[model samples]
Target: MSININSKLDSQNSFWDINLEGELDVSTADKLKEYLHGLVEQEVVDMKINLSSLEYIDSTGLGVMIGVLKKLRTNDKEIYIINPKSNVKKIFTITGLDKIFKVEG
Candidate 1:
């Protein structure tokens, strides 16, 4: 129902380390989008998102990530998805988004 996002920018501002903890659905998708967009606006070079604590993700959540990826790509930046739970990882695989985003176990 609610998602908690914790993020830290590296010393050089080269990348952001973000952790997601909760369901990522329509109700919570906008929060993520806004947060990431704000970082992009600040010209973040890259992002590393840790999803080990994330419980769920729906289409809207995926869309938000895609949108952010697109925006980051414009500046040649990228997002690295880390430690996604099995179910969440499956969503990316089944949707063929695995190839689009850099997913790590």
Candidate 2:
């Protein structure tokens, strides 16, 4: 019985640093999509996601990220994942997404 919490913070409306807490599974990935899908209209340059507080992520969550990336690519936007936990980082590494996305602490 894990309850996933999704939240975000905007930096000058130019950068979006989304923070994830708890689990991000099939049941909760859509919440993230809904939060991020409307960013196409923003004049954004960087989309930084703060993963410091993120506990877990699933394939569905990763899919959500890929979808967001596709949308951003059309606008020539950039995205980064920040401070992902070790276990979570393993997922990115195992899935080979760390190379595709700029992940930094």
Candidate 3:
């Protein structure tokens, strides 16, 4: 299934809370990237990506996340992923992204 990404901004913390669902393949990665780009343009300070509903993610999705992390770091912002699925967590673990990005419970 195609991926669905929805985002909400937290006024108190200046954080973007994103909810991602469905499959994050090559076709859907661009939407995720664009959402993050918009957040960057606003100079957001923190991000909390909720991945509990996400079903699947491939390398393209991983690349998009890595790119976002790099951009956020350049701006001195922090990004955290919440409740990643086991399969997706495995991918992050294999890529060593679990070390780079903050994975929250």
Best-performing candidate as measured by lDDT: 1
Candidate 2 residue runs with Cα over 4 Å from true position: 1-13
In candidate 2, residue 54 scores what lDDT? 75
Which stretches of candidate 1 lie above 4 Å from their native place? none
Per-residue CA lDDT of model 2 for 1-105, tens digit only, reads: 143444354656777766677777788888778777765455445688877777888899999989988888887877799899998899999999999889896
C-alpha TM-score for every candidate: 0.96, 0.83, 0.93
So what's the TM-score on candidate 1?
0.96
Error of 2 at 101 (Å): 0.7
* Model 3 steric clash pairs: none
What is the lDDT of every predicted structure here?
0.94, 0.78, 0.87
> Higher-lDDT candidate among 1 and 3?
1
List all candidate RMSDs to the true structure. 1.0, 2.4, 1.1
Q: Candidates sorted by lDDT, descending order?
A: 1, 3, 2
Over all chains combined, what TM-score does candidate 2 have? 0.83
Backbone collisions counted per model: 0, 0, 0
Instruction: Give the worst 10-residue stretch by lDDT in candidate 2.
Output: 1-10
Please give the TM-score that candidate 3 achieves against the real structure.
0.93
